[model samples]
Target: MNRSHLGVLIRMVTWPKKVVFGAFLASVLTAILGILVPWVTKSMIDSFTSHIDVTKVFLLVGLFLINVILSGIAHYMISYLGEYTIYRLREKMWAHILRLPIDYFDNNSTGQTVSRLTDDVSTLNNFVSKKVPEFISQALLVVGSIVFLFVLDWKLTLALLVMAPILTVIIVPIGRRLYTVAGETQNEMAAFVGKLSNVLAEMRLVKSYSGEKKEYTRVMESGDSLFRLNLAVAKLQSIFSPLISGTIMLMVLVLLGYGGLRMADGSLTTGAFVAIIFYIIQAITPISSVASFFTEYKATSGATKRLYEIYSLSEEKVDELDEYTNIFDGQIRFHNVSFSYNKNSKVLQDISFTAQPNQITAIVGPSGAGKTTLFHLIERMYTFDNGSISCDQLQIDQIPLSNWRKMIGYVMQDSAIMNGTIRENILYGVDDADEESMVHYTKLANAHHFISSLPEGYDTVVGERGIKLSGGQKQRIAIARAFIMNPKILLLDEATANLDSESERFVQTALVNLMKNRTTLVIAHRLSTIRNADQIVFLDAGKVTGMGRHDELMNTHRKYADFVEGQNLKMAQ
Candidate 1:
């Protein structure tokens, strides 16, 4: 492992230092007791050949019982400590993930991120909690067994030493291969999970478009890739386990043969031979543990690298400024502001506009003309490259991100609604909203009537993304959500785009209610929706071509006039 991985290990271990240390000490004591058991048994065998006292026999049995009980206690504590540590680490990792910038989510898949938090963290947790104690105990046993072997006969100890290099030669290359395969398996598993999540989320679309066979084929392909990678890892383990076990058996056979010759010459006692054989078996157990440790270490290193990559990302900074409280005067200005999702191509170029207090500013544009991007910029979801955006003459960047967002309400094109009760979804961000306020806002959005008509009334559950609600009902609920915020600025992006004429009429009325006495920015798809806008900013190819009242732009700009005429003709048809 490198310094960084070692550092991560140290930090995790030290998080619950007292518990970890206690577990480590208990493991060491258990290993010492294990080493003492063989010596006691050898003494008992010699005593049986001579004279066996009843008290001595009982005392020996008691010591063995004590060893077993102590070992069990130590094992239990180690397990407990390991679980507690894993819980704390996972919580910290999850909190960090939640606070990450919006752009990070744009580039990474939700499934992959979930895999790291669940699968990868579990891998690390297993190593830290189970393997670490086991490795330490095994190391102590190996050393203690070797010391006893040398005491019995140095020549026999030297003979067993010959097997160490042979074991290393067999284990090292296979261990490296196992590590490589383990990493590939994890990556494949993450991809499979990502694909599964995407398919499940879009199941409605799949059935609607009759793409079930295509989706099934795609899922099966991902599953096959994961299966193959896992099989490769299993194959390497199959080779490794037998090679290490066979080598240990071979050493034991050689020891038995050599000890028999010595015994015939009266050079070794039966008790000594028995003890040496027991010690050799004890030594071999740790050798197997060491092998397993190497394999686990390699796999854990890969997981550690993935987690560190996420931890290394810079978090979005929000400075605390007492001058900018959670309030906006509803005056917004963009002064030659420019931005791009990728810096190579500008999405919003040199854009300048002012949304006056208590007035409606409608942004009209072609599909790729950066209408939604403007809302993203205002929310500071993505930072701009040049110029500035100010609210009430105060630079937006100087305000706290939380305070800035709190002062504005947003209603998206899809009318995003989380899975919850009608009341719960409406009061999502505004937890302090009273029952009276909720009812008033819902009524204003024309959602209260439908909600009251439901069997459960305000308590009715909306399935995932409000799937139970119609498009218009979802829009009204969203509008009610924005209404409850009572924000100084309201952003409406295609608020009435997906509704039927009657639904549109209700949503449009709710929107007009929401816009009362607040600076509002509307991204309109149907030109008629924004016909009464205080100012219409016409955009094409990421630049503003005209800004004025709708009627003025209809006569002054040919592109605007052409857009209006086309919409009117479509309405007539």
Candidate 2:
């Protein structure tokens, strides 16, 4: 194993140091007691063969019972320590994952992340709960048994020592092969999970396109690949177990033959011969257990590596600042700002605009004119490459991300809603919002009437992504969510694009009410919606083509005129 893998194991084991140490001590005591059992049995047999004393027999039986009780208690502690270790590891990992940067989600699939948290963590859990404790107890037993055997008959111990190298030669190579196969199997499982997540998330799209057969074939192919990888692992394990057992049996046979000859010649006592044979049998168990530990360790190592990759990712930086005491004036300016998702292509270039307090600034452009990209930059979801974006003359990058986001409200085209009660979804991030304020905001967004008409009123549950509600109702709920925040700045990204005329009128009215005194930047596709905007900024190919009131742009800018004309023509059609 690499140093990194070893480091992970050491760190995990040491996390609950006191508990782990206690468990270790218990395992050692358990192994010692286990070794004593055979010795006690051998003594009992020898004593019974000679003069039988009731007192001595009772004493021996009492000691045996004590050993059994102590071993059971130690075993329980070992299991407890193992479970606690995994609990701590999983909690730490989950907290770290939740704080990762948003871009991390963009790069990784949901299924893969879920697999790491569920499947990979389970592998680590199994190692801690089963493999670690088993390995420790078995290791101590093997060493103690060897020492006892040497004391009983050094000559028989020498015969057993001869087979050790042969066992190592067989077990080590098989372990390495199992490790490689196990890693492959884990990777294939992750891929299958990713594919499954994609299919389930887009089930509606698949069915709408009548692609059920295609999706079935794709899922089956992924499953088949995973199955084949697991089969390879199974084959290796099948070979590994029997080979170790065969070697162990060979050593037993050789010992039995030699020890029988010694007994016949009066060179070894019968009790001594029986004790040595029992020790060898005891030793065989731990040897097999150690081999199994190697198999589990290699499998868990692969899982640990995957987990480490996620744990090592850089989180979104939040700078420490004195309390943000400055009240936002709702003035936002982008001066010579540029940004790109990739190095080769620019998404926005030299973008400059301003939205003054208590006014509506409409951003109008073609499909790929970087309108939404500008919103993302303003929200600090993605940082700019050049120039400055400031709110109230303070550079945005200087503000703590959490504080900045808290001061602004964003409503997207899709109206994102969680599966929960209406009140819960509205008061999601606003923990301090009272019932009065929630009702007031919902009323303003024109969502209160429909919500009130529901059987449960505000307590009614919105199905997944608010699928139970109408498109307009969902959008209005989103507006209500933003309204309850009472933010100084509001970002509306084509909020009315997907609604019908009647729904648009209702949502637009609610939006106008919500925008009463906020700095609103609306990414508008429908020209009519922005006719009264204080200023309209026209953009094309990542550059600002024009900026003015609607009437001014209609005569002064040809591109703006053409865009207006195209929208009007589409409406007529």
Candidate 3:
């Protein structure tokens, strides 16, 4: 997009060291063969004027054949090497993307990220694999032609040199402008792609809301903006080829006039004049190719910027462990912890609590009272700003995230089922889980009976996000998944919320058994759900207003008492 950005691209190409070197060598060979053929052509032309020697003409023809064959081989190798290098680069870039932190994906759009991985990578691929080699070959040809022309006669070479300064005044500025436009176009295109992805992912929601016309208009507007930006870039690039060819053609005309006078004065030979003219025509190709090279470079510079932007995202921290084991003793603690999703507004403040070994701790509050946020912190989704959290006396921050997460089993209100068979979903967390244990947890979750009714049983496909199953069915399957993991600590976020009364009753019975001899934290809206909890913590506006057993809180705590009464009345109705 700018000078520094162009410099960055040049540096990017050089990263695949072997490919760049091979390209350089191939380009040199190709240019040499190209220049050699022109000399042979001149020799063959000159032979007709004199002795009419068959042997000399045949030798020139043979040399020309060798040049063509060698050029083909060099071209093939250069292109092959460049493509190979780019393939490896694409793989490496993908690997880098996969290693990035979860927060990065949370911030970026799936469409924009996918576009960068696909379109941006493709642009860079073209630049490195094809254009880079061609640019180098053309550059060599231009330089060699100029040197040879000077050796033939200095006056003609001086005439060509006069036009070189024009590049600074015209081509440089145009290239700069093209790069700027191309960069803007790429950004706009990515944004449009992002919008498209958003719409596609939420197409059901869009249709349900009856916003099709409004959404279509917004998409069309984005497309129009992209088209306009691309048109501007194309227009700038279109001006270059004709201008380059015209300048070269003008130089050719001037050379023919000036050289004729020189030949008449007997200062230049007829053979040299013809050769110089041929060189001028040949010069156009290399000069124009060099211009195309810069143009392509500018576009790819934009792509490289986008690619590097993804590569530069910070990755999650990883720690080396020589030996490690899950040592959670079914206990958890929170001491003076404070948290906020944003700096200005705290979602949790100065909260203190503990879940004893083999006990159930339920959290209940009004909506937006930070109930869900507490479970997130306990799971170490985000570290607290003040105080500490410990799992069986181990500070969470000291242990690796992977190890810490493995010790806890979580079942949320919305069932997250990946696209896979029932068996795979049930054992997603464990490696090579035993079938005996699998059947055990499925029965415990009240899912085995329903799954057996399916034609495929445990092998039935869940489809995307478990769309194949009903709400209550999906929830049971999720519970079964978490149940099979056999985690030391269990976190349930309204686990039975999706079920009908019958399903909820069944799931509640399963949960009561599952909570036995484990540290259980439950976030509940229904008083019936948390009525039997060993300890109930009542939250309101980021503050813990009450803490006790459900009956104790209902009797003594005003907020908990109101919540239970309201829920009971709703259930009664």
Candidate 4:
């Protein structure tokens, strides 16, 4: 809010020479044309006293019309420059947000980040494009006016300068309050957007719970807060604007009375009096523009502060090596790996295990036993606190994030599906995917038959989050996506846990095809998944309790035996 805000403003402005030069040219024309009109008016008035000069009258009228045209041109150029600046600024923010570390997203809401990127940045665009240009031309007019006023009569110019300090004393205090209010309004706006996005995304849950009134109340409170802040701004402007105008009018009245006496004594000519009136009237508009520029700048600083925090954040480290290593064929080892979210008590403690190349490593435990947290760690969605997870001989963090992630293909319990054609979903992160491979992978995943049966086949649009497709269909689509990725390490996190018996069989079959000859990690409660794992690592309260094949664990570990028996997994025998 202080000197630091200037840095944010400077960063937000984009200077394309063509646009900058155009705005500058138009601004100069606006100021020069404006300054000339009043001087032409003075000449017309003086000529009227002697004899009516038609040419002078026509010239004065023409200058006024041209001034209007120049003003319009200045506005258009400035506006174009503003929109261009915002477009580039948004591009940078979007890119930076994508590269930002996972912890940033873990701590911040999408609503707040999106609000800064879109709405808050718009506030800055308005100031830079519209307000700053106006201030510049107004500054020129004000300076030009003062220089001429001193030339006309130095005594009167000094008298007008006395008002500056009084105006400053009034504006400074209210400006601080306005800055605080503006900040609160922006924050409330972000909260409101976040709430609505969450509610709408989960609208089905809300309807089933009959919680409409509760959500309405929460949303209304945020809206009410914004309204109050906006009202405060309105009230401040109502007082701030008129108070300055009244002072300027009082100065004008004083000038008129003094000039009238001077005329009576023949000390001032009629032409000089008329000319002074013209200059003062012309000076009024730019003065108000100058005042508002300062006041509104205080408001824009709030938005600048929000964006400043985002820009200051460190991005995820990605150092691409000279070559991509085929590291997945080597075993993945967790050496005393421990982690916690927000430094709370550890979620995983001294956990160590290994998954060999091209084998199924299943993780199983009760809910809240840090089962899914294990997958998150292996994917490097979070960094562990007290240990090292390495592929081959290199620590995972030492490997470039891109290199590490490129080897992984994850399919979660709830399929991640965007609203797009099935082909697009299958080819989501894949590059240069051919139509032939698309069909081949879908066939491998057992998806080609159902897809070909659909009227549009692979071109069919899935509704948001694949809502139009059943659970098994979504799973097959995800499996097809995994197949296309051809990753070395495939992660299946309870991929078949939610499907019905019939759907589970089909999806299970597809998953077996997808997992074949890949270093696979599966987190499951399903007996079928556990029964097939080459190695089953049992986690109890974040500690490694058993590590063996399912049959070995059933004989050696009573907890594993009871857990599987409770699910009626014993009946399969």
Per-residue lDDT of candidate 2, residues 1-573 (tens digit)? 362663564375445667667777777877887788777666766777777767756766776687677667767777887787778778877878877876788888989888888888788888887888788778888999999999888988999889888877877787777667766777777778998999888888998999899989988887998888788878888888898889888898989999999999999878788888878987986788887887777667765677777877887775543474444577999899999887679889999989998899999988899998898888888878899999989998887877788778998988799999998888888978989999988887778888999999999999877878888888888888988988889998877776678767777787777777789999887766668589899989999989999889988999998997887723621
- Spell out the clash pairs found in candidate 4: none
Better of 2 and 3 by TM-score: 2
Worst 10 residues of 1 by lDDT: 1-10
Q: Backbone clashes per model, in order?
A: 0, 0, 0, 0
206 in model 4: Cα distance from truth in Å?
A: 1.4
1-573, model 1: which lDDT tens digit per residue? 352562474365335667667767877777777777777777777677878767656766876787687677777777777677778778777777877889999998998898888888888888877887678777888899999989988998899899889888887787777667766777777788888889888899999999999999998898998888888878888888899889989898889999999899999888788888889888987798887887888777765666767766787774443554855467999999999998999999999999998788999877799999999999999999999999989899888887788778998988888888999989988968999999988887778889999999999999998999998889888888988998888998977676678767776787776677789999976667667688889888889999998779878999988876765623721
What is the TM-score of each predicted model, taking all chains together? 0.92, 0.93, 0.89, 0.92
Q: How displaced is residue 523 in candidate 3, in Å?
A: 1.4
- Indicate the residue-level lDDT of 562 in model 2: 90
RMSD of each: 2.8, 2.6, 3.2, 2.6
lDDT of each: 0.82, 0.81, 0.78, 0.81
Candidate 2 least-lDDT 10 residues: 1-10
Scored by lDDT, model 2 comes in at: 0.81
Clashing pairs in 2: none
Model 1 clash tally, residue pairs: 0
Task: Name the lDDT value of residue 120 in candidate 4.
Answer: 85
In candidate 1, the residue pairs with backbone N, CA or C atoms under 3 Å apart (3 or more residues apart, or in different chains) clash, namely: none
